[model samples]
Target: MILITGAAGYIGSITSYHFLKNNYKVIGIDNISTGNARALEVLNKFDNFKFYEGNFGNLELLEQIVTNNKIDFVVHFAANTSVFESTQNPLKYHDNNVSNMINLLKICEKYDINNFIFSSSAATYGEPKTNELITEDTPKNPINPYGLTKLIGEYILNDLSNAKKEFNFIALRYFNVAGASLIAPLGQFSKSSLLIKIAAECAANKRDKMYLYGNDYNTPDGTCVRDYIHVDDLAIAHIEALKYLKNQKTSQAFNVGYSKGTSVKEVIDIMKKISGNDFKVEMADRRTGDPSSLVASNKKITSLTDWKYSNDNLELICKSAYEWELKI
Candidate 1:
């Protein structure tokens, strides 16, 4: 069986549904610290899904689930992911993102759960020295606590794999993950500080205005550029990564993105056009640890696995998020 941590969160819930549809028995765990109750309600409809509402830090609870379910693989997605908040509370990020991962690694080692997949982020790349596509080989130089924690997690996995040959892992460093599950009717429901969600909220009149962190970046339109990959495409990448690990039996990391860059102003314009609502946009000073541009070169994952982008259009992403916001 496959175990998915943070199964009630945005990407995890959609991934659980994807696995169920593919006839995989899944054991899901989440503490609901930042997860939504509605996501759990939707996931409860699947017969192949068994959920445990608790943190992975509970070793006894993790032991019970692993022993009872015979979990052989894991997709870990639980962590505090706010870049700005991580700046204010670095210890919290280290404890939750790094220490919690060490705890989970111990459980995996004890239970002989060798196959593992991690939900990493492009934040780990920090400020790109160039405006080129960020390949997996790019040097990792995280600028904030959030990105540093994730980078440390990657280091721990590498160390474990080097010592234990049986342990194999795939760390997917995602760019900007947005949108919602069109098929499952699940959206980004967490109280997120992400740009797309905040923009969608403003478009829906839930917020007064959306603030652009910086409009003076060295890019087109003088705004920061990022590669926004739909949540559904990211879910597919996880499944493909799992399949690749089952056969390769090696530890590797891949960049999960469209290899294209979109500016902050462009995203706002797309959201406005899709929602048909002209919300107020305000310019703000550059936030600390903000990067000028970070786009991914997905050649590694695309060539290595059967993963392909199903929803690469910006309009589709905005529309899916807009529909989900209206429903919630």
Candidate 2:
């Protein structure tokens, strides 16, 4: 059985569905703090899906779960993930992202759950020193508490792997993850500060206008550039990570992205074109801890694993997100 933490969140829920469709029994745990109940309702439709509404950090609850189920692999996606919010309440980020991760690691070690797939972020790289694409070899110098906590979690994993050769993990440092699931009616259900989500909200008339944070960056369009990956593509990466672990490959980190950069203005323009909405876009000051440009060098993951991109188009991604936004 596969254990999925934060399975009620956007990427987690979709990933759970993929695993369930593959005929794998899935055990999901969530705190519902920022998770969506609608996601749980959808997952519950699957006969092989068993869910518990609680924090993964709860050692007693975790013990109950591990003792009951024979968990083979763990896909961890639970954490506080806002760069802006991380800056505001650093303690919260450290406690939830760092402390809770440590607690979960302890449970994994005790339960002999050797294979782990971590939901890392590009934020761990902080601001890139150049405009070049980031690779797994890039220096990790996080600028925010959220990034630092994730970095710390990676370090802990590395340490654990070193101490116990039987323990292995793959950390996928995700870029901007967007889009909704194509197979189901599922999508991001929580309120978000992500550019695409906000733009979709405006396109769906859920919001009055969308804010363009930081338009004076050192990019071609003077806006922050991000490599947006479809959520299903990311979910596929997790499956590939599991395959790598099953093959007993060496533990390592891989960058997950399209290796193409899209500026904030470009994304807004695409959303406007796809949704046919002349949405109001107000220019705003740069948010804290946002990089000017962050594109990925996906050569490592593609060359090493059978991971292939299915939805790499920006227009299709925006349209999928807009369609889901209209439904929600």
Candidate 3:
């Protein structure tokens, strides 16, 4: 069985479904913090699935699951992701992102489970000025607590692997993870993520205005550019990564993205067209630690396994998000 932390979260929930469909038994853990209970309701439909409502940081709860479930591998996806929030409370990021990750590593050690996968972020590399694409080896100079903490978490996982020598891990450094779950029946919810939520708000008329976080970025439109990979593609990557690790493929880290970018205003404009609502838009000062552009070099992931992206350019991404907004 595979143990998935943060299983009620956007990416983790989708990954759970993929594993279930691929005929793997999955045990999921979430504290209901930053997780949608509705997502868990949809996931419970599978017979091969078991859900544990608990935090991975709680060693007692985590130990119980690891002992009772016979967990064969772990795919960790729990962390504070907001750049703004992390800046405000560095302690929250450290306790959850860094401390919880180390605790998970320790649990793996105690449980004798050697294989693991992680949901890392492009935030691991802060504000790229000129690199059109970021590779796994890109120089990391995280400018915020959130980014620095994720980078540190990656190092901890890698260090654990080196120290154990028998344990193997695959850390997927994800760019912006967006889009609804493409498979029928499990659509995106309002709480799925930022981009999707923004489109949903515009679609629902809940938001009369949308704020573009920054407009002074050094890009064509002076807005932040991000890779914005669809959630389904990311789920597929996780399954493939699991299989690759099962086959003992030894790569430790790989960037997961389309290597394409969509600007901030460009996304809002697309949403406006799709939702038929010209919501107010404001260009504000640059958000702290936000990179001008963060596109991943996805070649390593593709070459290593059969993983390939299959959805949503800028306009399409926004359109699908709007559609899901109406549906969910």
Best by lDDT: 2
Q: How many backbone clashes does candidate 2 have?
A: 0
Location of the lowest summed lDDT over 10 successive residues in candidate 2: 243-252
For residues 220-291, write the lDDT of model 2, one tens digit per residue.
Answer: 989999999999999989999999999965897999999999999999999999999999988889888988
What are the runs in model 1 whose C-alpha is more than 4 Å off? Answer: none
Of 1 and 3, the candidate ranking higher by TM-score: 1
Which stretches of model 2 miss by more than 4 angstroms?
none
Ranking according to lDDT, highest score first = 2, 1, 3
Tell me the number of clashing residue pairs for each predicted model. 0, 0, 0
By lDDT, is 2 or 3 better? 2
TM-score of each: 0.99, 0.99, 0.96
List the pairs of residues colliding in candidate 1: none
Please give the range of 10 consecutive residues that has the lowest summed lDDT in model 1.
Answer: 182-191
What tens digits encode model 3's per-residue C-alpha lDDT throughout 217-244?
A: 7888988888888888889999889889
Task: Point out where model 3 deviates above 4 Å.
Answer: 187-193, 249-251
